[model samples]
Target: MALTVDKLMNDERFSGDNVLQFLLYLPFGILLLVVRLLLALVLWVASIILPNKSGVRQMLSTLACWTFGVYVKLKGTRDPRCSVMVANYVSCLDSLAASHVLGTISLRKWKVPPFFASTLGIRNAAQFVRKQHFAECPSKPVLLQPEGGPTNGKGLLKFTDWPCPLGNRVQPVAISVERMFTNVTVHGGDSRSSFPWADALWFLCTPVTVYSLRLLPPVERHDDDDAAMANNLSAAIAEALQIERTEFKWEELRPRGRAPPSRRAGGAGDVTTLARQVKEVLPAVPIHDILRDLAKTRSVDVTITNFLEGVTPYTPEDTTEPRPSTSKPRYVTPAPTGVFPKSAKERQLSFQERKAQMIAEAKKRYIEKNGLNLALNNC
Candidate 1:
């Protein structure tokens, strides 16, 4: 889907002259930068003097959203009384996108590196750092990005080991960057490297567009007990964002090979009692008939080894048919951190060798078990 109207605006027919149009955008770009910087400075000052005040911040954020030709559509409820909010990261525009939805103050990490320092939006966010005197504000709802950086829609970053001192209930807000307006003139990669101030005026006036925010239901944790609440809240946020838990794919998280003896037959005897009930209710059917029916009806693999306690040899010829060929697994290499490796040889290495070896190994295991691949080829 075309996320923004700029796709239509960029067509040559919209702008009269191809060569002169580029020149026209040059001045407008500078104007956008100036406006954004000035507004950011003003907000920073306001945050210091009147720390709890959010009216001006909300107004500016709303204006920024409007300047970008973005409209926020808030779903679900946001309690006016709530103090904490958390969300998924998409782009720098996420803060502006969530402005009207909750009118909450967005939280950023303690330090934003110098490379990303030029962003007026990010600069405006610096006041909320925990060390600052302004951080004590009681009225403002703290907005947090658990992932800590933009993902560019490739996939979600894991949230299992978040390092924040969370409150009772976290409002999980999901911001989808439906589209972006790319200024081809600024060829730099990533938001941090690019001069956000350079094209600010053009973005402000030219209507650089984005879409809305979808707020999921608020998640609450009652107990202060660490073990019970930690995984529960993590799982809740993952479910709300439609993030898969298996994405972690670590050894500890994977299902165990077999039930323990206690679970299987003795101690609690839950499994034994269930087995007895099943034996009483279900008729004794031959294993071959069940296997054949499953092979014909289901896409999953359920051989004799999958069910029976004792090993029985079932050769290829013994089976009625061959299994369908599955596609190769795809391993997506994470984007380069933009730092060069120590040597030229490192630069020459393929992504599989440089960063994706572990991911490839995991993909191989997944493919072996499920007859599916999740790897993507390099562009």
Candidate 2:
């Protein structure tokens, strides 16, 4: 269906008596514009009187989310060390969702300079701009939609050439719309039918909507060079946004293909090895003891045998046939007993490796089971 703006400007839907309808809408349009402006003024006053930090912004965002009937679901932990968040541009709802759930700062690229300048929410949003860093102001996590505008639920060209500094590690987020609509006069307007205004209202008035924040693991900042950091940050954001890394197709918006293997090959492998080594080192721990410890302080159910089975060195040829039974009577080995890993780094490294390996294996299985035929046919 054509949008209201398009119907008014291009299609002659607004011709004849429609002109009268347009005239009727003029007053409501003016009223909305005024209310928006007042709200913006209030936000400006609040920013001046209250703290100019993420907490205030988040509280305001939560209120806005409630006002719009939006609920935010945060999946993973936000890296406490990092101060930046990057996400896919789905709708204007992303701003409210991100602010409320992540408690991080958000930013948007507007077609017009004064787009939301009159709304208190927008006024508060302006504080996240990258240029306002000199006022002893902490830079809020900026949310960019790169797409710049909405499309027909189709993700389009949204990334730009502007260099984003890596002064803060960025947490990539994905925003998905559970339900949405456009141009049915939930409120009234003739020219207010474009995506910008229509979407803003949908985000403002919807009764119930859900937003999910899938936080990818954070990347370390290794360099001080802005250019290099920006490039790295862009790459990280692209990965977080699930942009196709191998092919440069902007039209295909859905995440396609498996994540490329890490450039630091031995690094990820080291994690797997460490996990296996820890299991081997503590082989004397009884399965019950290990399981009890995991149940109390962790969620892992993996036993020493299972852990060893996963990371034990094996060759492709080893999978050619099953092992032959020995002549001796079969015997079940007793569980090992030993002290657990003590170093925090060692424990963390082992856990991360196991998680990464599981993710990789899952992806591999999915690709193998589905294959290229399914992807092309489904698409």
Candidate 3:
């Protein structure tokens, strides 16, 4: 879809780019985070004590959202007649805010406890039924996200048709999330790597996250074509949100050539450790440059290879002490005395030649040690 990594994910939103600024805010942010979390928890408990449909319960929920630094503003009126609402996916809080205003039950299937279901507007689906069951029973208004997953609010992902057939008239809601104090991403784009819990934690860390939802008029379905209906509704929501529609799906939002979070080793949790590993292989490469590539590739070997192959361009930083080449013995062998490489291409060629020479020498030593030379002469 020609979508860049930045469009799908905010890789540098909370980045420790400016060491001084991060250091200055770390202590204050943590303190505010703990205080806000406690207040939100108390409010949530109070809301649970009240009746579900009670106006007091909704007010308590609103207070809880405020405590959690989530501010929601609703623009258009929700159609009471339509029981199905479709919105573009952005964050976990989308369901929370929608539930707060529209009182809709989220059908996005979050694997959390029932206790958390009230707060998140999510339900855990058992093996037998989930959204399908909700679609059948039209008791409460059901909220479904046709994008299937979150994206950085730049554009709209192609919608899925599963939510289209839930109701004859689907309500299209355009949701936009913005932050205050710090310019953080509304949602972490990669679903495979980022979870709802992580997003919630970041929410507490940030000062405030504002959600603006515009409820469009109900989209009436004439033909029984779910795909066509979904597409038309998607275009409508995109126009309302003033964002372009992309052919990109949620699955395609993952970083290109990157491994899933579980498979990502050193760089997954501790990127600095992975950068150090890359630094060991390419001593001339800067730590920041190594970290940048590791953030994208999330692998020490891949970052090192990127530096060695010149796939990632960087100017060599001056080193106080010269270090020996640290490339693996199998892939790269050391050159003879006084030999040096002036360029990446020459260095690679030299390594390959040295590796070949080493292999040939190993073969000769094996033949000589095993008396194969004498045997060949006899033959």
Candidate 4:
């Protein structure tokens, strides 16, 4: 199968592409959306009040899933001993559906309301922690989607090596979603990553999305290498889902709008060419300064961001020799002789004034270093 961005991403909108269809669905979708939000609020409150994994909590969660138009059908036996679950990511709510059925906590890094996190079975944990941590805790099996991001459910993205930290024996849970009237489950456009809450909103707006979850038997690590093990796990899940595994990575899904023209073309290109591009954006910035940052960042947007954010320190270019970027801000060494402020507020104000002065001085120095003043004089 051809592996284009469109093939991997569901580029379709929730409302059909046709103007008439979108207009017809708009009013009803909005009304249905409001009702679903209310139900979600109730579920959130219930999750907080009820005990963890209790019958009431589980029942409310199941009912919430049904109410939100997420119907799940479970198949195959889950290994009771496997604490870590490797699953294919289809939607942002894949974790929620897995939590409801398999009682697994999806590992996440973002901050969510404590109650919501618990209700959704989301935990913020280190990615490289030992498997013993997961193995001892059977109540909360950690689910790792090695693909790192969502796909259009047609193919599996290359599995990352992140799951290797979580033991050898992993229960592979395959989640496949079927949307009524629309094939699109996850919308793709310019978003760098999938937002769970945003995707959940679509779940409520849609007529119904059926999730067919097949829990395969636990896969043990026969291979010694981590990469080999990850590949083996990917192969197992891909075979179960009946989808071809591709070399396409999750990063490929991200829009390259932020990337430099050269980077967008495919390669980083020559360093001098990249530096000149940054120079075009910031003429006052010296060539050496731009080159120094380009070597580190290797992206036009990031290098420019660093300069704008004052993260990169400027070194005066003189004597035809390049100076390394110093961690010490140039303003720190040359302290102005003045009486120290006694009050906390006064001290803060004084600091701000000094910072402003520093910025002004840096700008003046930059102009002088690049001979911009000479150009202005000539003009």
What C-alpha RMSD separates each model from the true structure? 24.9, 26.5, 19.0, 12.4
Instruction: Please give, for residues 47-84, the per-residue lDDT of candidate 2 as tens digits.
Output: 45766456776655654554455677778777765665
- What are the per-residue Cα lDDT tens digits for candidate 1 across 194-282? 33343333444453555446666666667545334445544555566664432321111111343432354443343334334333322
Which residue runs does candidate 1 get wrong by more than 4 Å?
Answer: 1-54, 109-137, 160-164, 180-208, 222-379
Estimate the TM-score for candidate 3.
0.59
Estimate every model's Cα lDDT from 0 to 1: 0.46, 0.45, 0.70, 0.70
**Candidate closer to the true structure by TM-score (higher is better), 1 or 4:** 4
Clashes of each: 11, 12, 0, 0
lDDT (10s digit) by residue, model 4, range 1-379? 5667557776655424555665687788788888888888888778777776457757876867865788889999888778778999887667778888887877653456776666666664532233444555656677878786778888999887646645678888888988754554544332322245566677788777889999887878874576787888888889999888898876567443445334465344467786887777767678888888766444565466556545566754343457867785544445666887899999999888878777767776777788774443232
Q: List candidate 2 segments past 4 Å from native.
A: 1-59, 111-139, 151-158, 161-163, 166-168, 180-195, 220-379
Which scores greater on TM-score, model 2 or model 4? 4
**Pairs of residues at least 3 apart in sequence or in different chains that clash in candidate 4:** none
lDDT at 273, model 4: 82
Give the CA lDDT, 0 to 100, for residue 247 in model 3: 84
Q: How well does candidate 4 score on lDDT at residue 353? A: 84
Better structure of 2 and 3 per TM-score: 3
TM-score-sorted candidate list, best first: 4, 3, 1, 2
